[model samples]
Target: MKSRFLIALALSALSFSAFAHVGEAHDHGGFLTGFVHPITGLDHLAAMLAVGVWSAMTTRRLWIAPLSFAALLLGGALLAQSGIAFPAIEPMIAASMLVVGLLLAAQVKLPEAAGAVLVGAFALFHGAAHGQELADGSALAGMVAGTALLHTAGIAIGLGFRRANQWLPRLAGAAVALMGLNMGWSLIAG
Candidate 1:
């Protein structure tokens, strides 16, 4: 636990530098852009990765969880483009990370339906944020595709690690929760 916390702290410090490189030239803008957006934002990265880890821990249907998130996230993005309002979205996004992380860390085994509902709700908020960024004319397709890819990568990593190390998921969850706390503080302070 202590080692995990230390690693998270180290990664948190590195996040700022990670975002700074977003404007630089990269490979394919499509997936890379989407991938960068989620990882660059502390809150989004934590929440999305937590979803992956939690899904791996709780369900054997690995693809279903991420696909569900992607579909609903696209729906949310469409809503945002249409100028729909979901108040307190940023805070909700942060809270999702905290909630999902804690749930995974505690190994909460929720029913399938309830888990789906929870993940869907959080995915909507995340999608809205992505849509808003896209709507603002910030590399729309690339960013979306990138984020989706990153999400897949996170899920793959979670699934792979979970098979070997039982403690990995909890460690990931705790790290995610710490990131959420940091994001929450930043939002409140800012």
Candidate 2:
């Protein structure tokens, strides 16, 4: 138990450090950049991980939310690539973290369709925000693959914590939520 708490604390602390790089410029032309983007950005990382945790908590289906998120994320990127305008994408991305983080912390269970729609909606914003920067086909594929990996990690952690200590995942969720709130405030303040 002590070790688990320590691990969670370390993750929470690392998340804060990771959050500092949200808007830094990265080479946007390759698979490596797309792959590294989400893991390096706390806003995307927390939201994606929360989606997986929430999906794991559901009783019906495990893949629906993640699939919905991935598909819609791609669609959003496509829309952006095609020159479609999506206003306030950054704010929406931050909001995704807050909303998803709260849902994960509460362990909210929704019908699969509702879950898909909810996750998908926020996913569009995330997709658009990054999509504008990703112009390469391989980069898009890399982003999708990287996102899928994060979802898998979240699901695994969710399942493991479910059997070991229920509060641990919830604690992680709260930390994510707090990070989201901080992110949102920074956007507003700056």
Q: What is the C-alpha lDDT of each candidate?
A: 0.67, 0.78
Q: What's the true lDDT of residue 85 in model 1?
A: 78
lDDT of 2 by residue, 47-139 (tens): 898898878876367889998998898888778778787887777777777788788878888889999999999898888777777868889
Prediction 1 global C-alpha lDDT: 0.67
Flag clash pairs in model 2: none
Report lDDT (Cα) of residue 106, candidate 1: 79
Tens-place lDDT per residue, model 1, 1-190, is 9766856674664333111121223322244465567667766666666777677677777656666676777777668768787777767776887788887777787776677778788878887777766533344555555556766777777778667666767777776775666666767877
Which of the numbered candidates is closest to the native, going by highest lDDT? 2
Which RMSD values do the candidates have, in order?
5.1, 2.8
